[model samples]
Target chain A: MAREGNVVNLVENFKTSIVMPTAQSFPAKTVPVMESDAVATSKRPIIRIDGVTKTYRNGTNALEKIDLDINAGEFVSLVGPSGCGKSTLLRLIAGLGTASAGEIDWPTSTYDAKGHPMPDLGFVFQEPTLMPWRTVFDNVYLPLKLGGVKRKDAHDRVTEALEMTGLARFAAAYPRQLSGGMKMRVSIARALVKRPKILLMDEPFAALDEITRTKLNNDLLHLWEQQGWTVVFVTHSIYESVYLSSRIVVMTGRPGRLSDDIEIDAAYPRNEAFRTSSDYGEYCTRVSAALHSASAAGDGEH
Target chain B: MSVIATEPRRLRLLPLHFMRSETAGRWLHAVVPITFVLFLVVVWEIAVRELGVSKVILPAPSVIGEALAQNWPVLLRSLAITFSVMIEAFLLAVLSGIGMSVIFARFRILEMAVFPLAVILQVTPMIAIAPLLLIWVGLDHVDRALLILATVVAFFPILSNTTLGLRSVDHNLRDLFLLNRATSWQRLVELELPSSLPYILGGMKISGGLALIGSVVAEFVAGSGSATGLAWRIVEAANDLDTPRMFAALFLLSGLGVFNFAALTALQHLLLRTWHESAIRTER
Candidate 1:
């Protein structure tokens, strides 16, 4: 029931449930219907990008007429060459910059009970970006403190996020004392403390060694499964995208446009066994072919 | 009974062993400099006595010490006056310098418009204008004239250092703060001020010495009839050819400068030991 993505049908059902007085009269009939409706609403696409284009001040066309939909609970990866605008598109989605042509809509703006617009999304940049002066716990407490949550109330959530990132012991340690992988974990814990519905990561593990990268990749997948939040990741690594994403969007070179959109039919909780399987190899080959053709097309345009 | 007796004896020797190994190097580092100064003073005392130098020409260290003890009441009163003037001037310079730097951080136009004027004030010699200040404020209010002169000499370093510090915020951290939608007031208090603390303290170390020097120079210009600062005492002793008294006053002045520098260093260490690289003492 939580896998349903049609919000229109859910709204219609919600209207009928409100109109029919007998629906509430029977407690048995109302419970399942209401639960399904809530699941459907949660599963709907939270953001829609329609015909968006971005051109910088120096007349470089970074992205041209890009359109995409990001639904809740789906893990999406944007993969492309170096000059492609995957990072630019992520910044646009983050509202850090505006698109030149079209509109990007947040269809479902989640609000708290107090009617304050909760920051329902978190962003991780290429670097860990932790303040060197603060400890891991204080860095994780920043977003909540900015939102006016008292320190006493924010303590539990901060501890939970640190534990999820496997950094519970390092909460009091400064960022300078941490290794690259540990600093990145502190960044992840900072993002997760807000309990955001969507997590946007931009090459978060690009600076780590291959062994550490693989370990963090597995840890991130486990956290995503346990939390059941939507993830939109940006990376240039073909193997990483194939291993982590449920759906991959390959983009064109320089003036980046959508080139290919492929889906992997693999099962969830993918571990080392699946990584060595024939099916994973096949998916990787297919995506590599798509990337090759996309780059070739980009060469022809110039 | 034997175990308890040996335990107390062993514990008493623990500090001696620890100092011999771990803290011995630090103690040596301090002792070497003091030992060198004492050696130099002994050489001077011997040279003066053996060469049969006139007492009026160059007083030995013992004679200077004796002079300091004999005129303790008058010298102490004069030292108090000079020390008070230095403190007042330093406080005024710090408050106004930090207040102006904040203004400059908030408004680029004001900084551009008035920064050159600050540079001009700094480059112009305080000694050249001390007489002018005395005339304007009058001889009766010599302390106030000295205050203005010292403040002028001590204000520039803090303004420049703090301005650089405020602009030195990490680019990535600034972007993160903006992404979180922090208010300007929050940015200044939480980010800018703490980031600028080491720089401000560094500037204070320099200005601390300059304030004392300015007080002494201004007192020289104020002259000796009514002013009772150490500088005036040096001038009166020079005229009377009392070389020992002159050396005594100079000793106190140098001691005050060293004390000021040591105090500021301690403050910097106390505040920045947790995070600043300069203050942290790594084993390696």
Candidate 2:
């Protein structure tokens, strides 16, 4: 129950969230247009990646040539060992940091030097990162608030986001007042409220206790299925990757590079039965071997 | 107002700030001890009359009541003098202390340069410098200004505590604000001030008592004249060996101290009514 007008009215305020007037520029839908005429394309990659390399200047490279493609609604997890480039990969996607040599092309986010255009990004840190001073509802309202939505209109979207994360009951609670699991849910709710096309998570629950992590894993899968947004999740744990991913991009350590791309064949709507199944174990074993191969890149050359 | 909770287990149910219910139950809780004090006073009155103890040393409570009535105006005037000075000093101390703390907090070099001076000002006894200060600033203003010195002495704890409160923001919370790209002013208003409130209130509690002491000592060091404060009255009463008047003035001084403390405590409750843990406990 909310006051006065429709609480979901904030969505109307965000109607200006698209590019300006542009001529139709298709690549070659029928091969007649491209051959006859050259109309400059949008070059937007729902998310685009172009030769993105990250070097830490320690001679210790975190990610090298991290050129990976992410489409509009793809769920991709960069899974590897602790020092591998998985987290780095997510950070670049989130626009939290920059790559040294390559460029990230999220046709949605790539911008020229003048910054005329770039995709908007929503980042979920490894921790909840909920502002301690803000209530769960206010925290969720942040993106809409920043997006210039009026306060009254923002409440509905915030409430909807909290409800999606099962945090609606605790909407008025402060982060410090929440359990660790609940705080993580609040963070997720905050990210979802913005409805960003690209959601980047960097080891979101790596620090959580086992049961809580498992529950969040399943919950996250359900949300992912419902939202159908592109998710780039980063985690060091192979088991987490096997359990939750639709596709896993494993990477090597030090001079971090793509080690392997393994597709998870588990059926959708995974539950407790799937988590405990032999197929899950077999997948976990296979992921581990891929990680080992990545870790031991040059050892067998002799 | 039926506002106080006489219960305990319900403590955790309210938000953390409103948890202090034991205080609201104070009157109900202190009933036995208050009755005991009354009992002692009555018994002592009977014994004093029966034993014929002289009014010279220990006056009867009943007798003192008469003296209070007789000297009420003088005592009230002196109280007005002392309280006014105390309020002025307290306000001045707070303004200067917080202003400096902000500067000191933001600039390490200023902290290094000014903190030692603050310590020197605090540790240097007020009386020893009183005569010189009295000379530098005429007796009246010097004494009042010395009241400020006491105020400044009293001001530091709050400033330091408030400074720490401003700094102790959680890292995760800090990152959230940073990610929002909040301006410095926005960060300070939204984060620093709310978090520092409890500490600032806590510091003010101690400072209230200190302010009263500073005023009294300033009067003590630079003795009161024809028209001065309670400290002057105390000196006059003690010298005349009018023990009851002296005790009466002492009682007034201590009473004023308690009064100041209560006002601060009440103000703290009013301001932080919904926000502070101590206030929350009290409310619950």
Candidate 3:
């Protein structure tokens, strides 16, 4: 199950990536204060969240003084309890909503004359939000179509996306005809169709069963590795965070704030062998403990 | 690997099973309603013939059929007039209703200013307004008056339903569109309109019936001899004490209503059968 050959292939691919700082490897409670890894990656940041704060009109501080930098080609997971505002942070990064204070800068990204980020960005919601009327191919073709690409012009890219998601055969199938997991694949394909450099996913596979979630987690890691996309995934699952992300950011609940930043130093192409290995379990335990303490600390404030 | 291998076979069988039940359901749906209608017609024919009901009061189904056959030319002409009016009113309602709804969706202030006026027209009862419309339109333009009345009656449902449908877009999908930087016009054509289609079609079904009713009500109120609609024929037959001919006209009117409903329903089925839950038939 280790598929040792895949590790060799992924190691060769990894030479192109920057050397990420290995921080707080295990024993979550014994860990010291998080050292800002901004200088460690050395590469230019894809997104810089500088002292960002989000307060709703109703006076809930969804996120407070959040400062982080997501470097290019890194898989970062925002993991915490239910009300942690991980989603709020993701939404801010996506520019779906405005922040109450501070700035989110994409220094490495391009912007158009309108002062809008012009980088190819894809966002996946918790639900597979596909148009029921459209077939899988049509759904994947949407972003390009909105960008004024005709069907004939977009045909190959859409097909390539479907192929990547293993959905090429189901291209003509309507959303209702697909299983939940398959629908989510179509959604992923739709996101990837634009060949986005940044992918912000909010619990994209949380609705799926364990088996499907595991399979998708593998597929997503593979896709990220192959495409070299900067990924910001938000999830409540510690095991999933440990299994998928290069770094896990733990946040506390109810006026969420970042509590800990733990970097996973595991090698690439993690498979069933990695999942079952003692190293994976240790990372999961660390993430789980950090999550527990973060939530407990949040509760103590009340 | 085994699970993957067996999945396609299972997937292939599901549609065949669903389609089989679907065909059976369709067969039952058509046969039962038709059988019940025929049964009622037979009972009506027998009861009228045996009880010796007067032709002037309760014409037998057989006599009504005879009257229909004899007046085919006159009835056909009236049908053509009534049908054209209904269709014209319906098409007008559809275009105006959807157009106004889109406008309302785009500009909320306009919807606020105008929607209540629409509701006022809807709730005030078209029958109460028909006579006034006739007077205002003038006897010289009775045809135009009928079209306006029918259009009013049929317009509201499409406008309201389409508005609700446009508003009912999945919020996540809306965010997705916003993320992709879809323009308002592109959003309307690609996302809003297609998503709202089932609602528009639903409204169309209701409005279709209303259009026919509006035309008949207008003809009744107009009372102008120039208009040769089926409603006019019914009035003329009533005045002459031709109960059989009146029944024949009423029969034609009901037939038209049924046809209108069936055609609209079929159109809805055609458009939404693939995606909409309401249109797709499910197995028990």
Candidate 4:
């Protein structure tokens, strides 16, 4: 339900950062200090993008002539060194930033040439961008509030979102009070509250210690399975890219472009066993080589 | 039980971060000056009789005290009247200042257009403007309120600080609201206003003192001469050379200033107690 079966975006000449602030600044993934439900990801592309390109201001060709499709229920991670237009592609799909000259048409039971993706998107920022003044519950409920959902109906959904992220106990807490991983949970909960068909995430867990990051990766796949929403996750870490993603879209540096799309041949509800498997190590090695080749290609572009 | 030791105090410090506060100790130490007043009063009594200085030159502390006690009701009545004027002036400054700040925060063109005007109002001398306002608005209740000593001292801080607070919100948080598709009005109410609370409260705190001072200044000029606020009492005490009575009135005025400062501080704490750091401190 989640995986889009075909790949599209093959960007070129993206004037991106090898160490753009966005890479480090993306919100660190945090497991809420609560219960954990290990669900797996769905399979199928609910979102489709054909021939999408983004050129940022200042003559930075962030993404060039890219095309990709995402299924309704799948965990797809965009992996790159840095300044690879992976995040840009995610942002374009989220409708946060506009694409320079391509169609981002969504299948809303309608698709015109001029049509863009669904204007209503659930975007989890890299910085756990929770409002400081509101409680975790209020922050999560914010999307519903904007949609004009009454508080009574919004409350239950907000609770469920929190519970899914294992943050129900801390619903009344503020963002500043939470640990790094917990804050990310609230960010995830807020995104989930919208029930968006497509969830765009930008390295949402790069700040955490290794142990916490792996836990969140596992928990995320579980939730992806249960909810069946298309997820576009951006990551710079090779280990994380391999652990959770059904499809790892490897990108290269400066004029960030996608270099490889390696599909994980493993089965659903992938557990601790997958990470230690020999196949996983092989997959990691292949993706590592792909990343270096793309980086070398990017150097050639310069 | 293990206890965390306090960090050793540094000898030299960054001037801005350094605090010379001994709030509790200072309050306790106030006893010295208070008792000094008593000792001085006694010494004055002895010196006056010994030197044979007449009552007209400088009345004895005893004489001033007697006069204040004897005329207590009259001084109390005048204090009440002064307080009444102060309240009216303070309320008007607060209401209009906050109203205008909200306007400027929402409308950029209006801010650009009117902000200079506000700065002008802040720098303009109140004493110079009070007479004109008195003439135009008349000496009636509305006029009295209109010519209130509020513009420079009170209203400006309220306006400037409030505008500063509204503009000080974090960029990412602002983007969050935009992503949520919040309407402009919703952004103002849900995001801008709440974010601006500390600055607004701080402005209100500063403005509170300004408003009180303004009322007294206005009362001094337009206060029907013999029938004004604490200003009139000061004048009446001066006519009779009653220093204690003058001090008593002066005390009430200073007390009003203290009261305004504390009231705003309390209101700030009440509203922001849960979320804000500045409001919950033991000493500000």
TM-score rank order: 3, 1, 4, 2
Better of 2 and 4 by lDDT: 4
lDDT of 4 by residue, A1-302 (tens): 11111111111212221222221232222322121112213433345455566776788888865655565566788988788788788877766678787655454324336753344457888888777778898889888887789999888889889999999899888777789999998998898887776678888998888888888888888988887767789988888888888888777677766567777768878888998986777667766777878899888888
| Poorest lDDT segment (10 consecutive residues) of candidate 3 chain B | B1-10
Q: What is the TM-score of chain B in candidate 4?
A: 0.75
* Comparing 1 and 2 on DockQ, the stronger one: 1
Error of 2 at A154 (Å): 2.4
TM-score of each model, in listed order = 0.83, 0.74, 0.89, 0.77
Q: Higher TM-score: candidate 1 or 2?
A: 1
Candidate 4 scores a chain A TM-score of 0.81
Better of 1 and 4 by TM-score: 1
Worst 10 residues of 3 chain A by lDDT: A24-33
Screening candidate 1 with a backbone cut-off below 3 angstroms (N, C-alpha, C), the clashing residue pairs are none
lDDT of 4 by residue, B1-284 (tens): 23336746557533312334455455546767788978988999999888987766666777766766887788778777766766666676667877888898777999999999988877888878887777776666533543355545677887888788888887667777777778887888888888888888888887777777776777666756334677778877778786767766776778778787878877988888766766444645
lDDT of 4: 0.73
Q: Residue B218 lDDT in model 2?
A: 75
- Superposition error at A236 for model 3 (Å): 0.5
Against the true structure, whose DockQ is highest? 3
